[model samples]
Structures are given as structure tokens and as C-alpha cells.
Target: MSDEEKRVLLNNAWCRDADASFAFGYALRADKFGIVIEGKCAKCGCAIVRCSY
Candidate 1:
């Protein structure tokens, strides 16, 4: 995904390190309904997923 889209997802995801950015683990997955982004919080190292339609 583009940097802008990644930024939006990372900003909106519910993560412990709210002030930090995220490091994407894989490419985005899209289904008929929406998109799924899987990654980890840069600061806390916790797994996170952001889904968007």
C-alpha cells in the first residue's frame, strides 16, 4: 500500500503504542467486502490488524 494509506491505518489502529508507528509484516489482503492489513507496532512489538472497506 501507499505510505498515506499505511499512515491512516496505523494512526487508526487500536494499539498500545499509540504514539509510535507500525512495521507492516505483509502485503494487504482484499476480499469482496474490504481490506485487511497485518503488522506490528513499532514501539511495543504487538501484532495488529486494521480492516477497512
Candidate 2:
């Protein structure tokens, strides 16, 4: 996929809620590898987890 497509996919990735207090964001790359996430929990103050595909 092109860089633009990859960027679009990354911007619309899904984030799982396992043990997080805040909603995390994800970004998918064109390599079809894994997803990257950012942000921390507001209540637990723990690092947000990202479930990659």
C-alpha cells in the first residue's frame, strides 16, 4: 500500500479495551505488521495497551 493509504488506515484503526481507563488511539502501517497506540489511562495512570493485528 502507498504511504497515503497507510496513513489513512492508521488513522482508522481499532483499539481494544482490556484493562484501560481511557480510550486509546491506534495507527496501522502499510507493512501489515502491527498497530501503534498512544495515550495513558486517566484513572489508573497506566500505559495504554494496544492489540495489534
Candidate 3:
């Protein structure tokens, strides 16, 4: 899936976006750097947690 499409799924989970734009406020800003999501995901809406480093 594409990045935009991934954002759509994230939006569905967080409901951060409802306009189908797949854009969220947090997406523009990052509290920490070098943060990443590991393991297989993006098919069943897994719980991808991110915390500040």
C-alpha cells in the first residue's frame, strides 16, 4: 500500500482525519527523531505505539 493509503488506515484508527485527506496535525510535527515502526503491519490495523525519545 501507498503512504497516503496507510495514512487513511491510521486516520480510521485515530480518526485524526475525517476528510479523506489522510493528513493529521501530528504528522506535520515530531516530538522525537529516529523513531520507527517495526514488524509487520498495515493490513489489520495493528497497535503501533510511538513515544518520545
Winner by lDDT: 1
Question: Each prediction's Cα lDDT score?
Answer: 0.71, 0.46, 0.36
The best candidate by TM-score is 1
Give per-model TM-scores. 0.60, 0.33, 0.26
Q: Report the error of model 2 at residue 9, Å.
A: 12
What lDDT is reached at residue 22 by model 3? 28
How close to the true structure is residue 53 of candidate 1, measured as C-alpha lDDT? 87
Regions more than 4 Å wrong, model 1: 1-3, 17-19, 24-26
Task: Supply the global lDDT for candidate 2.
Answer: 0.46
lDDT of 1 by residue, 1-53 (tens): 78898678667776665655566564578878688877777767778777898
RMSD of 1: 2.7
Q: What is candidate 1's CA lDDT for residue 11?
A: 73
lDDT of model 2 at position 13: 35
User: What ranges in model 3 sit over 4 Å off?
Assistant: 15-53
Residue pairs in collision within model 2:
10-28
Error of 1 at 44 (Å): 1.3
- Cα-based lDDT at residue 44, candidate 1: 79
